[model samples]
Target: PARFEEGDTLVSWLAEIVGFSPSDTRLAREVPFMQDTSTGRPAGKIDLVVARVADTGLQWYGLEIQAVYFSGRGMQSEYEALQNDVDPYPPFPGAVRRPDWRSSSAKRLMPQLQIKVPTLRRWGSKLAVAVDGPFFESMGGPSSNPSRDLNDGDIIWMVPVLLPKERGGFLLSRGHWEVLTLEESSRKLLAAETVSRNAFEQTLLEKLKPLVRPTE
Candidate 1:
């Protein structure tokens, strides 16, 4: 068995576990090499991309996997904000507001990612960051920093996969993010996906209990 560093493999594995095809499950390295239109230049390494459906062309729903854990301190607060509202960030500098999800990522570093399906588009582009440890220490989000405005476009949604539950289920202060146990929410997903080490996944499923923090 191999030790995996990122979720790109896991998700791809999941897709395959559930029957996604070779044509559909493209590894980031396999996607056509295009200079990022946003930068008008090539970035060193891109992560993952998947065709929207059975026959969509190169335009894909991109996927980037991160192995960061949100520390317990402010997890619930962050989770609450995401699960509460679906508005854009307030207009720039002095609007003192949040922009809606679409436009937020539309005009910046990531720009609008062309999702494969128009309907699933509402769920916004799927950016899954699977983690094995704590991500931040405080409950206040990046937006709370007065000097900075955290734009929604940077990334609108998060799919957190808890890899290390024994450390503490995304430990957080009482008022921050809400952590959903992976064992409970993802039982079907785990069962459906053939993770190489079934026994270990089962063990962790019981021990760690991963969570999803759905934003509002």
Candidate 2:
């Protein structure tokens, strides 16, 4: 599936976990947030905006998805490069650089936890982040290294888990939403480590082997 489709799947799963009916949930992708004055282009775009009907009325949340894969180099190195690429300005004058959306690390997940979450809250919306298992594990188990003070009602972490299936295969399912305390997040950050691509793929396959059935 394409990246957007994977992200949508995660968001839909999150909506159900949050107790919103299908009819009550609305997801908008690549929603524009800011416009650049100089280039007349959008300065910022959000991956997904989730709107749901609540008893009080309509509520909205921002969902950011990150699929941290192991490149040949390193995940952290790739992240840093992406961060540098998305920078709107250049380090030196006459650098002749344009903002490249493809290179941005989706605003870097950790930084978003600190900066974007507060901004979203001030706008009357909450922030939720969805990450694949590899990415979740890489970040120290989803609760690691939180820079901001978090509350149960504040930011949420949506992670996928492998569940045993009745049919003898495993199903990748969404786990319970985790609202990280500062302490939990801190510990995770300390434990975070980068894994190689081959190792990551091997581990993933091993975890899913029980779910893969032989061809008839």
TM-score between model 1 and native? 0.28
Q: What lDDT does each candidate get?
A: 0.35, 0.60
Point out where model 1 deviates above 4 Å.
1-9, 13-24, 30-39, 56-59, 67-125, 136-216
Q: Compared with the true structure, what per-residue lDDT tens digits does model 2 show for residues 1-216?
A: 144353356777767656677888988888877679999898776778888767898877777776553224333544455567756543343223343222223334454456566667678666677665655565455444343333454566777666777866556666645766433443443454579999999999888755578789
Model 1 lDDT per residue over 41-119, tens place:
7543335555435544343444443332222354455556666657654222322333232222222112212322222
Error of 1 at 47 (Å): 1.4
Per-prediction TM-score to the true structure, in the order listed: 0.28, 0.55
**For this target, which candidate reaches the highest TM-score against the unseen true structure?**
2
Candidate 2 Cα errors over 4 Å, as ranges: 1-8, 53-57, 73-107, 142-153, 162-171, 181-216
Model 2: C-alpha RMSD to truth? Answer: 19.3
Q: Backbone collision count in every prediction?
A: 38, 4
Best by lDDT: 2
